[model samples]
Target: MMQLLIVDDEQIEREGMKFILQKSFPSLEVLEARNGKMAIEIAKTIKPDLILMDIKMPGISGLEALERIMEFSTDIKFIMVTAYDTFDYMRKAIKLGASDYLLKPSKAADIVETVGKVLKEIVVDKRSRAASKRQETVIQKTRSIIEADLVTQLLFEHVHEVNVDLLIDMLEIDRNHEVFVMNVLVPDSSDHPYPLIKEKVSELGNCLVGALSGNQLPIIVFRDKNVSFRFQATSFAKKIITVKQHHEALGWFIGIGNVYSELNQVKKSYQESLVAAMEYLSPAKYRFYAEIEIVEEDFFDLRLTTLKKDIVDQIKLGQWEAIRTEVLSLVQFFEQQGASLVYSQQRILEVLWVVSRVLNDLGIEAKSPLFAFQTIDYRQLRMETGQLLDLLKQKHIHYYQQLEADNVQQIKQYIQAHSHEEISLETLSVEMGLSPIYISKLFKEKMGINYIDFLTECRIEKAKKLMQDPRRSIKEIAIEVGYHEPNYFSKVFKKMVHVSPKEYQNAIHGK
Candidate 1:
């Protein structure tokens, strides 16, 4: 079982986390610290695998506490929880190397999923460590046991079935609190969470929850009953925002559910949060329950006129590099605005639509290399707005690279297959069914060599190989590599190789 520690100033938050974490992963051992002093003390003794902690406290803030904990023991991974969305705090946390950031009132689902992913990574790291050891049998046996436990946890509800006290004892919880559930979802697999999720949640109180998996995370926020649910939810949203800014790669979309009166119905809230998130799918990035309708106007200021002009300008000039850069830049801008996944998807679709229209106007086939990507249905992909934007960027870059590779391969194959012919840019263009002018420019840009120089080099190299054999005459070899004039071939060869054919033959034969 993986050991986790929770540190927070509030007793309720600490106890609440323990309940949820215990419920999620019944076999876990949890430890709780009410302040920086107690957290440091626990770290010295418990040495838990993961720590979820708050950034702000009375005496030693979560940030300071994190520093001290790291000083005491560097191995304990931490996730920092903050009620506010302060870039300074995020920058500090990132600089300090906190594993993740979380907002207050994070759901149980989000917590579980995040923790599950971190633990999975930990298990992988442990296995790697064991593999490096000399005792192969013992390592294999230990791995098997752990793997079995993990598989069971994934497949069965045994984690939930375990009694709270037993689970707390297993997890080593030092506090008592109620459990709540948080669920988070995104387009891509978050099976491995950012390591910081554990540390952040631990600080909130106690994350008695299951493992983190994919984009969906279940959290259990432990706060006093007097605390406003909205306040906690707002805090949670801020923390997620901080996470997005720091780990921009995660591309997370967040949602919150109505709080449950008891822990038993916590899963219901998790489900509700999903519905809430799904409702505002069109924004490029989004936080659920932040607004009821997710006013589309907030994220996008769509100007069809400008977007069309940019696409046309890029395509007409063959400015693929600029097009890619601009598209990615737009995505980043929208992500910063907190657009929903649906919003980003729609935005990409709009861009594709405009691009396709431009291609159509130019009499370019919609399915041509320039517009081929539009053929695929992006709706099949289940991802949030930020993630969808990322995919768009990836696809465009990959498409450009693949096109470049194909072009290079075509040029190489054309040269090789027609090596024995009188090959010039014009001749090669005719053979390859391309325009002579376009082929010449493409060869220069793509291969960084001109037609005449490349052909001459090819012909001369063949002549040298033939000369090396001491069988073929220079005249014959010149013809074989498409050189009609032996004298000219000899001169070209001499210029490139700095040796006469006879002298080259003599040197090869040791004459």
Candidate 2:
């Protein structure tokens, strides 16, 4: 029961989008705007949850209109649509907080996905707002809800332009005292999320506890000047175990973050605790953060996070050389980090997982029997991690080569089937889910010649075969080989075969 608005200068586009949305979402109320002016007016009245808009309008261009509209309401999500693929428009739209964008002639699936993603974000925002309102209602109970929300926010680093001092005060964290973060994830299939958590928070003395999203409950512990951090952290870890043993229904997975001297570093503690907690899900019920092979210094490299994305994109483009280069770069990075053999093995394992994930999305399975990744070899894993990952890429290259081979075959089949019809790179690209450049390059790489030359060769060859019957007219044969003009076909035929179509037909007919 949500509203969506479609804004484009073209009447046809606006109407088309409206129909598409209505078909996809039966309950949604779809509104249309013919121009930016109409779109701005509709926003003033309706303030729709999402918008599908074009960039180049007659006056007050789509980008300008979006910028003006955002001045009043920053919440509305916009998916910018344009026929042009200019980076400038994309950059400007992003700066204006566009939810996403669609190119001209976008499919129904793309439209639905872009809209669905924005709608999901809106729902999450609404939930966070509701959670905040609930916390606001009960200020007296500082230890439970409000404190938990703030701590959770800190751990998630959800604080963007937030009033840090006010947040610090609300959590009641001391600057001088050493702080630690411990979180427990319990598996509960029941309707209730955390029965024992709420019941046990009251018993913990001077602890700042909070409930994170999903089934996580984070406990913030403080060590005063008199108490040692080791003693306090050890006691907290044992307490979580004790809590689970007593309340047997809630099978607990506990993670205790490292100790820190300042409240600002609670996020570090949260990260450590989160890693431990994640490890515990498949590992042990209780683990200390230090046991994790990876350190914070290793986590700060933005390159590592974005490297997987690069791999996915290059793989999608069928750029095997680029993927190989990136895989080596990743492995080399781990080698330079000089982390433990376990870390290097784990790192390569993660790389394999990313590659498999990308391949799986494309309906391609990456089966690695040698490196099952279920177990690891200590010595071979560290020194030969790069070569191991490099070797595994044969499957990826093989998949792409097969795909390209199949694609070339498909193009050939399509040309053969549609000998009489017009065929262009644009049409073939649409069919193959590849760009024109890629299609062109693949044709030469596979067939050892240009696409146009191959097409002409195919047409002339078919024309020669048809000329055997002698019952079909010259014009008919020309039309059958995708040529509108007989003279043009003759010119092309003579250039390639050293004989005109008429001469060839007459010679074969023994004229």
Candidate 3:
């Protein structure tokens, strides 16, 4: 039932309007106001769905009263009641947010029809306002969650329960039927796209529901039919728009999760979307799935198992070429299998992820020169794939060369130039102007050989060169390479070069 307030200065006009409304809408509850001032007060107190006001009231004109009433509650639909039908009066009432104007000598049926139409409109406006409020609340909570960095916190606690059922209830989804869980993540700080982000995702006009995950990440949850492939395509497009909008706005990275049948899968999708979003680190990525290509393979899946082991071995051996080869091979295999761009990128990321782990185990930084080069945002360059790849390769080679030519090479040069002197790690550090520990780490990474081992190899090679001259004794040659004590030098030479100093000399002379 709808509630209405009837306002007029004359008692007969008020009663007549009330009778006509009540008779027309038997379910409507009519309340009477004799003057404009009284109508404003009654509207404030009663909060009716519609207000019927006479324009020529004594205390305050109906239009004046309607203006005041709007201040109290703009939601109430007001229709001006007047004996006059001037264009000026109609314009003034509408400017004040009045629904319609009814003539005082108006036909009963016309007044009834106008009242009924205004009532229906008010109901619709009320519903829309309610939905808008709900969405704002969700946005607030999601923003709070993402900014809080709760992703790792939730994962570590093994707490998968995200109160999605309550959220679904708040979203007013029909509980009787099942809804597919679609999670979308945009790469912008705003959390969603501007124009198209909020558009309906399906023919039924179902909307996208989203919030921020604990990791300062945005997660959009929506529902549609999985049986219809067209629905899936539409859903993908909607999420892509969100990603594109955010990237355009804030240059953020966006990720999208695979479609899931159950709400329980939302958490997994949430995690995967985060990983997918990280692809922004490498640009021009698109919608990807979390569990789509995951096939259950036991230990007996020898082909993949062997491939994994091969990549792992090459990483451990510090064979950068082998690591690069195995990854490219895997990517090629997947591409040949008719994998989409999204699928290929996912596989490549997986390979890089493993490589990053191995580098970390070898005490390398988590982010490598290769990773950084591959991830440079090329959108600013406006370059195509071939150009971008060429640029990436140029950068990769430069960094790789820099990595190889760094402190280790400097240390190697210092060692060689001072082979005739008593050079130590301390002396080499001073010559290179680098801290001893820092030099050691650089040596290990670039040369794939430790400091003491390289120094020993250098000393032994110098000793051999000196021993080539028949005039040089084993002790003299040892002394020349910074070894003062012949016995200690001989011991070191034997240990390093696999022969006693005298034996080495004899072998060189064929004595």
User: What lDDT would each prediction earn against the true structure?
Assistant: 0.60, 0.70, 0.59
Q: For all the candidates, what are their Cα RMSDs to the real structure?
A: 22.2, 13.8, 27.4
- After superposition of all CA atoms, the RMSD between model 3 and the true structure is 27.4
Residues 219-328 of candidate 2: C-alpha lDDT, one tens digit per residue: 87776447776676666666656556555553467778888887778888876675566454244567787877763355534654677658767777767666556656
lDDT of candidate 3 over 336-422, digit per residue (tens):
565545444544554454444444444444431122233223231112333323333344455545655876677788878777677
Ordered list by TM-score, greatest first: 2, 1, 3
**Residue 62, model 3: Cα distance from true site in angstroms:** 65
TM-score list, all predictions: 0.33, 0.41, 0.29
Error of 2 at 347 (Å): 4.6
* Candidate 1 lDDT over residue span 1-511, tens digit each: 5689898888999898899888777667898888888888888887888889887888988788788878867667777777766546866986886877777888987887677666665555555566555645555454434433432342234344433333333333343444344444433334444445544544565344334443445555544567776667666655545555445443355566666665554555654454454433334344444344443543344644466668766776666566555555555655667665445544544454455445555545342111112222233322232343344445455555576578767877777667778667767676677788877777788778887777777777767778888878878888788878889888888899999887898899999
Of candidates 3 and 1, the better by lDDT: 1
Q: After superposition, how far is residue 199 of candidate 3 from its true place, in Å?
A: 13
